[model samples]
Target: MALWSGRFTASANEFTQRFGASLPVDKRMYKQDIAGSKAHATMLSEQGIISHDDAEKICTGLDDIEREITKGTFPFDINDEDIHMSIEKQLIARIGEAGARLHTGRSRNDQVICDTRLYLKSRISNVMRANYQFSRVLEKLAHEKQHVIIPGYTHMQHAQPVYLAHHLLAYVWMLSRDFKRLHHSYEAADCNPLGAAALAGTTYPLDRQRTTDLLGFSAVCENSLDAVSDRDFVLDTLYACSVSAMHLSRLAEELIMWSTQEFGFIELSDTFSTGSSIMPQKKNPDFAELVRGKTGRTVGNLVSLLVTMKALPLAYNKDLQEDKQGVFDSLDTIYDCLTCMAGMISSMTIHEDAMERQAYTGHLAATDVADYLVKKGMAFRDAHRIVGHLVLLCEQRGCALTDLSLADFKAQSSLFEENVMHELDIPSIVRARNSRGGTGDKALAYQFNVVKDVLHQQEELLNALTRSVS
Candidate 1:
């Protein structure tokens, strides 16, 4: 019999029972559902809404159910509708009337959301942990390759010279923001919403604060209507997942490009790579490409929920059941993507010689050449024009700026001097950028220190969140 069979003459058809169920998706939240029930039952007893004996029976039944689930002995039924129903129906069968009293002051509307919030708190903690670990991998990579100079690009054209650490550090800062966003999502999920029965307060003297404390929630959701209606916690996490996935996608794209024979900047580890069946010499960065490709699914999950929530007149609609599957998928997807990304980066080989060779081919020192002429008392525009002409002359002669002699430089502009040769040296150009946040030694050293400090903070946060999960 259905829980609400008193209101209906008979149960819905088997097709309706199976089609309307959320058990397949929400069964994974069994632990959270059991925890919520135990806490709610305790609160009900403390508030005198249920007898102490009944509360004990309910708590004992839920504990036994949790163990059954952990040991794969629990029978999950498609007609149960969701995890809340499956647990409740089983509890009623085991403890008789005591289990029926468990729902004295709450409804499945509020019950399911409470379970979801509890579940998200734990999952987001793990997501943030993986995020922190991956950030550490990138920081280690940057420190190892600190001195490797490569050409920085704008519009995919080399515009200046920079340290490889500078490039890797860019992704670190992006992930740092991702960590903060995930923390915000955790905070959003940390609120308690258990006592708001259905769309309004129950007649029973429900002690919401007691349940909040029992469940370890930081705050009790104050508005009864909003408590059952809100899905913002899920949306916040989905948004964070989308943003983090996008960051990983950007890194994946660069990895794919760098692994190509044309760039030769990096070689993915054999463990993280695969080869074609017919092509004997190919080692493809398939994992990186998959990370890039999976970003669309994460983004689509966010959009899927947004559309589900956009026009709903809420206080708990049937449409809200659409929330869990996508959020669960995104959570799983992001964690796997982060793990794969860390594995690829930690094991991949860096080809410094290739990076340096490509750096020399792009006339990467042209800006410094322009700055060189400017320093010699020529107007900046006139210096830029002179450097442009010098680049043209080098092109015509089929030579680099260093191959042009003082006589050849003087032919283009009288400002040419022997010191210009020193300016054209690749290392000098990189070292000359000593301004704050520039690619020079002093600036990068300072940046590395800041990165270390940021990483320390991230580690502390991950530890705190992990402790909270336990």
Candidate 2:
């Protein structure tokens, strides 16, 4: 019989039982559901709502159920419908009346909400930790490649020269912002909904804050209906995940371009790349491409949840059950993607020579030569025009600016001294960007220190959580 079978005389159709069963998905929340029940049982006993001896027996039986599930020895039934009833039914079979007492002052509505919050909080913490690790790998790469120069692009056209480190740090900043978003999502899930009961507050005298503390929540939900009905926390997490996945997709897009034969700026490790089925000499960035493609599903999951919740009223409904699978899917998607990306970033080989070589083409140092003229007392606008004309002549003669003679320089502007050639060199052009936050050595060093400190703090938090989880 179903848990709510008291109100109905007829058995549920087989199709209905199979279709409505969430065991395939919500079964993942088993550990959390058991944990919340243990806390609630302790609270029930401590408040004299249930006998202390019964509480001990319920706790012991729940531990046994956890072991049975972990070892794949427990009988999981589809007709149990979801994780909550499955665990409760198992408890009753194991410990009789004490197991029945475990649900004192609670409804499956609040119970499911509580379990989902705990599950989501733990998952978000993991994603935050992975994001931190990915960011650290980026910081290390940026520091190692600080002196390597690359062409800066505007509209995919060479516009200036920038240290490759600066480009790497740009993504580090984006990931750091992602970490903040995950933190906010964690806060959204950090409240206790266990005492919300069905649509109204529980009639029993219960200590909601005690359960909240036992489970490590930051606060208890203030309103019963809001607590049970609110899947906003999960939506917030899904939204944050969608944004993070989008950021990763953007990075993956660059990795795809950079590893191409045309760019040749990076080489993916063999373990990260895949061979073509028929092509003779193909090393494909399939993992990066997958990361890019998964962004669509994660984003779609976010939109699905938002629209699902738009019309549902204040308490729990069947529509709310539609929330968990998408949330769980998005989390798993990004978690695996971030972990893989971190592995790829840490293992891949960088082609510094290729990066430096590309920086030298397309008149990358034109602005440096123009700056020399301006420093020699020409108006900035005049300097720009002089350099423009020099480039035009070089194009006309089918020669590079460096191939022109001193007379060629004198023809353009007598201000172009012999030293102009040295000033227009590629390395000099990169070194000239000495302002704060520029691509200069001093700027990269400063950026590295800032990123290192943030990563250190993040690592500390990860270690602490790992210890707690263990």
Candidate 3:
């Protein structure tokens, strides 16, 4: 007989029982469910709602059930409907009447949310750790490749010369924002919702604050109905995962382009690359492509939850059961993708010669040429036009701007001088822009220091959160 079948005259149809069961989707939260039950039992004993002896029996039975499940000896019945019912049914079977007292002041509505908050808190910590690890790899790669010059692009065309370190740090900053978003999600999931039984406060002398502390929650959810019904924490987690996956996809796309024969900027390690069966010459970035492709699924998971919660009326609904699978899937996806990305980045061989060869091919110093004229007393707009004509002149003459004579340059602007040749030098072009955030040597050094400081702070925050939970 089902736990809630006390008033039913007949059994539920087998198909309905199987279809309604969340055992498959939520069984992964067994640890969370058991942890919540233990806390609830302890709180109940403390509040005098259940005798201390019964509470001990309940806690002991729950501990045994957790061990059995962990050891693969627990019997999981689909008819039990969810992890809560599965464990509770086992608990009652083992401890008899004492186990029945475990549910005296709680409802599955609040109970489920409690378990979810506990589970998501740990998950958020894991993702934050992964983000920090990946960001560290990026910082290391940047410092190692700091002196390697590459062409910076706008609209898919070469625009300026920049150090490879500068390029990699852009993603580091994007990931730092992603870290903040995930942290916000963690905060959203840090509240306790255990006493909001069936969307109303129980009449029993239940102490929500006791459970809050027992479970390491930051606060008790203030309103009963909102506590039972709220899924914003799950949505926040999904949104963070979506944005992080998007950032990974962007990085993956760049890896794909860089590994291509035409770009030749980097060579993916053989362990991370795959070769075609028939085409022996093809070494493809299959993992990078897979991470890029999986971004759609993570984004879709966020949208799925948003649509599920769009118009549902207050306190709890069957529709809300659709929440866990997508969130679980998205969290797993992004963490795995982060691990793969960090590995690929850490192992890839940067081809500095190839990058330098391509860096100067598209008249990449044209802007520096214009700036050179700007410093000489020519109006900035006039310098821009003169450089444009000079680029045209080089194209017609089948040579580069650097190959042009001083006389060749003076024809366009009297500002042209011998120093113009030095201005066209690629490293000089990169170094001249010494503004605080520019891609100059000093600027990159400052940015590296900032990245280190931000990383140190993030590590401290993550350690503090870990200690709180511990």
Q: How displaced is residue 355 in candidate 3, in Å? A: 0.7
lDDT of 2 at 101: 85
lDDT of 2 by residue, 199-259 (tens): 7987899999999989988899999989999988998899899999999999999999999
- Candidate 2 residue runs with Cα over 4 Å from true position: 374-382, 406-415, 467-470
State how far residue 409 of model 3 sits from its true place (Å). 0.9
Best by TM-score: 3
* 10 residues in a row with least lDDT, candidate 2: 461-470
Pairs of residues clashing in candidate 3: none
How much is the lDDT of residue 136 in candidate 2? 84
Query: In model 3, where do residues sit more than 4 Å from their true spots?
Result: none
lDDT of 3 at 433: 74
TM-score to native of every candidate shown: 0.98, 0.95, 0.99
- Best candidate, lDDT: 3
Output the TM-score of candidate 1: 0.98
Q: What shift in Å separates residue 51 of candidate 3 from its native position after superposition?
A: 0.3
Please give, for residues 55-89, the per-residue lDDT of candidate 3 as tens digits.
99999999999999999999998688999999999
